[model samples]
Target: MKVLRNLIAIGLVFLVILSSGCSIKSTNENVPSSSNLTVKMLDVGQGDAFLIKTSQQVILLDTGDIDARDLLVNKLKAEGITKIDKLIITHPHADHLGGAMGVLMNFDVKSVYDNGQITTTSTYRKYIKKVTDSKIPYKQLLAGEHLEFGDGIKFIVYSPTKRMIDTEEDLNNNSIVGKLKYGDFSILFTGDSESAIEKELLNKYKDELKSTILKSPHHGSKTSSNNAYLKAISPECVLISVGAGNDYKHPHETTLNKYKKLNFKIYRTDFDGTVTITSDGHGYNVLKEKVQ
Candidate 1:
């Protein structure tokens, strides 16, 4: 009788271990998978545009200057992107949304994301008209909405809150701020947002402002990239989009000095041509195209 009892106890222990192993395997299967999200900061002179390619989607943040349309099209073609999953205008600034009309005409876009806030530029008006004619789905993204691309890639809109939108400030202060996350990596894209906007976002999302990369706000203009904001973001690398010999003297010396003091690696499109960052869902690589 004793031998029989011991055999039953051993069998029960074995069953419990087997069930625990199965539970662990099931948990692993439910975890989200890693994704390869590639971000390309195209050199379109003194303008801003960023192409984000994920495992399941392709997104264009802005389109640079109107004249840069051809360059943008060629680059998209080279990437074999015949369609764009989403196009975010960020704002109605001429330099940011000017080439968007060309892109809308060239590609089959699933949707267009913008604040729908008008600006004084004719280019902005024309782009808005094109979107209206296309009848494509349009949505005004606001802060707190989290956008998810395939795999584990996600973007959180963190700026242009209701109060900021109502404030009669310069459009730059109202520019949309987007934070992208792919696994352990995060990137903050500030679209021409000035010191005031930056301060607001910093205060709102102080804990989440930590990012691995930063798209230097307003092309690294002195008016943006405030010291407090910079200290909060603490990006490991900074990318500045500006044109060589720009009349405005973009990427101001003061801003450059701030970045230098922080010891963050910097990549300037005007000097490096095109900058590309690719991630394996764990680590990222920064590649620069030599300016010809």
Candidate 2:
């Protein structure tokens, strides 16, 4: 009888140990990942461009207008970047993809990502040739796909789903909308998506739309950043890339007022030059170029 009791006690102890091990594993899986991601909104005058740097990777989003190539190259050189891990052309608009060819020619690119929409412009063809010559892997990101670059740094492509891609709508509507998450911080990047797309996103991912930082769509044009969409994002800071005296009058007064009403600190590339957001897993800081 004593031997039987001892055996039963040993089995109970083993079960307890196994349960404890599973609990620890589950806790580890739930812990948030850490990554140091720096997003730089390069001042390309009347165009849009951004650089994303994580601990192990560097990604360039768009390349701004054609003439901004030199400036973009200089910025990358200053940052000690000789290679680009990924290059994401949000759309085929000249203002967004014009200088991308220059980047492909100058840097070692691991992969290229775009919406895959074709355009007849010479600049677009030149970029395509560069991609072909480089022979780097290319992918057209779809909604719900997640990309992780070590250390828990993750990016979720939230727009331009396959259904939308097949319909052949406006290129702007096909813009790639991505959300970057590092630890507890989140930022949303909207590539010139207009009201229609914004409404779609708002309805689809209302809760997930919350972000700490927002890159104002369409350079803060009135056509984008609808009031309801802004409310849904509820960003603490808004970044706008626009030229000082551009023909389109970007960063329009009304849009500026909207952000002001929402109590969002506004950062403009036209006035502040390069805008950098640095985060260390918990919080982020925005650094702007010296205003002269």
Candidate 3:
């Protein structure tokens, strides 16, 4: 009887050890991997530039103002980036595409996407000349178009529809409005887009316009972020890219108050310098580099 009892006790101990080992192995397997999506809102001062990095590709959105050419190039180099897999110029405005020439000269750009809007400014002409000379594949960003950068990471264009009317209002309205989606995470980029376009997008996309983050339209200008538009696409976080002491008084007080009233978390390049948000397709973390 005693020998039988000892055998039973030993078996129970072995079972417990095996169960623990299995539990540990399962826990190790369940651990999450590192974040694969990183979006950096560069501080180009009164201009716009964003660097998006996925597991397999790098994308650049806009290219700061002319004065920021060297800084923008150096910033790209510091990240050890020698090539841009996809470059999207949201509009033809100087603050948005002024550094296009500098970027083309420095990096090997695989493809370029633009809203197909034309401007007669010197900077716009120079940009076109450089793009033509580079022989890079260029395409117009159209509504309903989809671009996939990696597994489960994609961009959906939602503005500048086929029937766009080329009027003065079309310049800002034609600004490429798109959303980057990865799993449950989504970010909306509205390049200088304002009320007219915002209203149209709200009508077209409705609930589909929801996002986790919003790059505030027109640098948080009062002309954008209308009350009706804000409520339609309620983003958890808002990023404003503007320069300190800018002439336009970007991120107007009323705009800030509206976001504040909505209880949305806001980060600004003017205040935070460079703002970066990284996500693992599930959730994201925001980090800022303070300007000295």
Candidate 4:
């Protein structure tokens, strides 16, 4: 009887240890592997181009305009960036896909991601060809997809779902929107999506739309920054990527007024030059080339 009781006690102890070990393994898999990250929104004239750097890899969000290709290449080289681990293009528009060729030619890009919208333009055709010819891994990002931006960073895609892409009938409305989250800090990258899509996001995300920073939609076009959308996001600051004297006259006064009403800080590439942000998962700081 004594021997049987001893065996039963040992078995219970072993079972508890086994269960605890399994739980720990699963928890570790979900935890971020790193803690430091940097995002640089370049001052590419009249366009968008952001560089994300982590200890494990570098990500290029957009490539700016066709005419700005050389300058973009020069800037990357100056920063000692010879390789890009991931190149995420929001859509096939000229300003977004134009510098793709230059990037592919000058840097070793390992993978590419875009909205998968084909267009009838030489620029789009050539850009696709370059991506294919170089044998880089290519994929289309749809809503709900998650990307691991190494160093404890995660990017949650919120727009350009396959359903939206097939039905929107407009490229701008299908622009890739995503939230880059590191610890408690997050930045909402809006691409060039305008009003209609903004409404969809506002309805779907609701309170989840809030972030620490917002990359102003469509360069702060009056077509976007709707009251409901702005209220949903409620970012502490907003950044606009536009040329100093752009023909489009982006960042319309109406949009500025909306940001002001919300008491959100505004920064523009035209006036502030490059905007760089660094984070340590728990907190972050925003730095600009100029006061604006």
lDDT by residue for model 3 over 1-292, one digit each (tens)?
9999999999999999986654211101112367899899998899999999998999999999999989899999998999999999998888989888899999999999998877789998888778878888889888999889896799999988767735444677788999999998889999999998888898899888889889999999999998887887798889999989999999899999999999778888888878878888877877767632
- Off-target runs (Cα >4 Å) in candidate 1 are 1-35
Error of 3 at 110 (Å): 0.8
> For model 4, how does the per-residue alpha-carbon lDDT over 1-292 read when each residue is reduced to its tens digit?
9999999999999999986654211111123344478888888898999999888989999999999999899988988999999999998888888899999999999999999888889989998999998789999998989899887788899998898877767988888999998878899999999998998898888888999889999999999999989888888889899999899989899999999999988878898788877777766667776652
- Model 2 has an lDDT value of 0.85
Off by over 4 Å in 3: 1-33, 165-169
The digit string of per-residue lDDT tens for model 2 on 190-279 reads 998889999999999999999988999999988898999999999888999998899999888999999999999888888888887877
- Report the error of model 3 at residue 37, Å: 0.5
How far residue 282's Cα lies from its native spot in candidate 4, in Å, is 1.9
The Cα local distance difference test for each model comes to: 0.84, 0.85, 0.87, 0.87
Question: Per-residue lDDT tens digits of candidate 1, residues 1-292?
Answer: 9999999999999999986654211101112343388898998898998999987999999899888888888888888989999999888887888789889989999899886576667887787778888898888888888788887888899988766666655778778898999877889999999988887888889889999899999999999998889999998899999989898899999999999999888899887888888776667777777633
Sort every candidate by lDDT, greatest first: 4, 3, 2, 1
TM-score of each predicted structure versus truth: 0.86, 0.86, 0.87, 0.87
Candidate 3: give the clashing pairs.
none
Give the C-alpha lDDT of model 3.
0.87
Q: Model 1 residue 269 lDDT?
A: 87
- The root-mean-square deviation over C-alpha atoms between each candidate and the true structure, in angstroms, is 13.4, 14.7, 10.2, 14.9
